[model samples]
Target: MAPACQGVAVAEALSIGVNYGQIANNLPSPARVSWLLRSMRISKVKLYDADPNVLRAFLGTGVEFVVGIGNEAVPSMTSPAAAQAWLQQHVVPHLLSGARISCVTVGNEVFKGNDTALQAAVLPAMVSVHRALSALGLQGRVNVTTAHSLDIMGPSFPPSSGAFHPAALGHLRPFLAFLSATRSPFLINCYPYFAYKEDPARVPLEYVLFQPNAGVADPRTGLRYDNMLYAQVDAVYAAIQALGYTDVEVKVSETGWPSRGDPDEPGATPEYAGTYIRNLLQRIEMKQGTPLRPATPVDVYVFALFNENLKPGPASERNYGLFYPDGTPVYNVGLHGYLPPMLVSNAARQ
Candidate 1:
């Protein structure tokens, strides 16, 4: 019933990472959150940025982190000096301080939209960051990569025949080459809830929720897929392989369900959200892999650690957390842990 998305006693070391997003004001301090995660046995966390406070709080906790460079910072990262300086200012000190930072994402979902300039800068920025890492003698030790949105794919159905959008190909081709040469993972944010909300009538709720159904098969590979999450992963693998790079590993940088939403957002209730997460947690516990690659279990980071009240999107966007800002769970999904209240300093305690 434990569901912190972290692995334990598995030979493959297969673990699930949780996105420790901090876009809310009422959440507990990073120190207390660290206690909560370790209590639940989660050792991997992904952050939207390299916040020094969070990094410092988790010092010596042994939780591996995958930090990021926001879209606004991508163009600047294209410069080698800027990349190195940024890393030194944000990442290096933490590493020296015993923070286990395992990866640096240059930019996030650059190809998901039509920002020509930002899209143009992503690969160069990645290259520059990677070069800076190598210069610092930490190339393979800390990978350089980016998280992508599933919208980058042109046709993700059927798994085996997936391909990147033609326009995206111009950028992805070289990006894949960089990832291959540098040995970094291709990260993607896959959300099955969007698919169900878009067409709940046709997209059976059980399938998206990971319940037992007839499941579909890829016409080419004839692989049966009972859930949309695995199919989305294999489709990404197909896309990467189509680009002629079979060696690059694809990781789900973000995936989760919203426990609450606006009236129009169908199937966004707490019950469905709990089901989606619970089922996914079960699969991670079993070390389940996609039908296409049984040997390589799908690496995932559940969308968030807590619901961010200030997130600027649909209600669903702000409500994707497994827990709320007050450190209380929004919905029960088999996993349970305690989030201690804020610690009092000597002056405050007195």
Candidate 2:
């Protein structure tokens, strides 16, 4: 049977979803923010956490949500009781109130670092959460999974020859089996911009930016790809297939280009960011699947909603937002949202 999540064909032109990260101090409240997303007709969202205020605001709005369980909470989630309590506190109330939640990511990129404990707890947390959802009669309705960084892929070149790092395979094998058994998607954070930035000389600027360019060929699959994003996605599919789990689905949890960067950061500009998103939106709207999975449309949640001023690291780390805190478009790709004008406008005015 086809995955239930893939059965619904989101109206491509108007169905673009954005990741709503709240790491910054200046983001608009969830209530006003609801108006902004509704105005753009965005019916899907992915949150880094199950924020109560955000959940309450989007209640009855018909926007489907993909909430998260932070890495710090992974250890707690390993226990079925703690997982149940967390659901009761963070998820159950919202679902009862008519929030359309579809997936719950257990942790974000737990395998990318040296946190052995977080990595070990990842799958168990997912299992406990899945069991809790089942006990509550919500398993079929909500998926349990985790997102991983592209760094987990050992070699992502040639699209079809993708393979997971040998080190990650030890942990990933059991994780994939869990997803296969439960029918949840395997989320990966794939960013082609990193390749271009790391090796600008070899990586074509036009290709990474989604500009017109002669594409590369995957010798094994004999498929030609015009864009790096598709190639990266296909590579992931290849990697997954190599693991003997062809039925498992792969989804992109984060992918975007920065609009600004430090002096040394090349290809980080408003023009490239706009171009990349516009082209990406166009492709996703076409319901275009990767070369490897031609029958399945790519599932994605764009990197971020707003520039996170408090985010550490390089300048580019904070500029991935499509909008500013004041509900202004950072660089237009014809999609913008406004936080609610008043905190209780929806509850009070409506």
Candidate 3:
């Protein structure tokens, strides 16, 4: 067991959210995480699941949450009874405990592949959940939505012309209507690092890193974008607008740079990660929205508070954490936090 988090404070409330991923053999208790989050004044958090212990730990803490239902459960969620049962079991208990459940994500990145059944079930599951929320009088208070990987877009370059792949539109059109009608936000996980890494020759390092660079112009909109993040966001806006739904909102549910990566993974250093987060935090603090929607402030959630060793993929997949499991900073973001001292095991006494 790790000691309860203590001795961390910042100047203002953190509108920024930090992901709480626990795919590791070792992790601090939810009680300790509560202290850590409160110490930093983080008012929002996104979880891959609705862990009862975690929900219990954050009771009455005023920390809004966006919880998810795994991909395997998407098909089951299409059944209204299953959806209501899952909500009653996993969600209602939390609400009963006074947990501030802000959003329920039906499935994550389900459109990234050819799983037509799962893909088709995405919107239905979201509908079931939204209807369930409405039945329970939680429609406006607890929004139902899903997150998508940037891969869903056909041509992300020159962002203003962005469009969903033809294959995804069958699912996206109805999905957009559901979101617009329910007044929920569309969540997208945008990673500019993936773009720069795949085409270093064409994608300038400075542009993706949020460093000073001569950015490209959108020939269509003539909107000057100096950073790739904003460009990616605006592209999504354009795609949504093209769908004939101009009233829906888009939010970045996941975005972060890794502090470490394999030799082949270019530009994944602590310095660059620090720069990306610092610059992003500055922009967010300014309440800066996309170039297309300057009046609406961009809502973002930074990925992974602690790196997970068990995450399978490229080295970068496990290295996006802002902090290590032992509660050490991966890189300074002008804020310092403390994790309680780790408890020792008897086996290590040898």
Candidates' C-alpha lDDT: 0.87, 0.86, 0.84
Q: Lowest summed-lDDT stretch of 10 residues in model 1?
A: 1-10
- Quality of model 2 by C-alpha lDDT: 0.86
Tell me the TM-score of model 2: 0.94
Cα lDDT, model 2, residue 35 = 70
Instruction: Report the Cα lDDT for residue 334, model 2.
Output: 84
Q: Judged by lDDT against the true structure, how good is candidate 3?
A: 0.84
Which pairs clash (backbone N, Cα, C closer than 3 Å) in model 2? 32-339, 32-340, 33-339, 33-340, 36-338
* Per-candidate TM-score against the hidden true structure: 0.94, 0.94, 0.93
**Native-to-model Cα distance after best TM-score fit, residue 69 in candidate 3, in Å:** 0.5
List, residue by residue over 1-350, the lDDT tens digit for candidate 3: 22322222333577798889889877777766776677667778999988888888777677888899999999999889998999999998888878889899998999888898899888888888888888887778899999999988987768889999888888889999989998999999999888877887888878887788877899988888889998998889889999999999999999999888998898889998898998988888899987789898999999978889999988898999888877788899875665544343222111
Please count the clashing residue pairs in each candidate, in the order shown.
0, 5, 0
Poorest stretch of ten by lDDT in candidate 2: 1-10
Model 1 lDDT per residue over 23-68, tens place: 8888887777766777666788999999998898777668899999
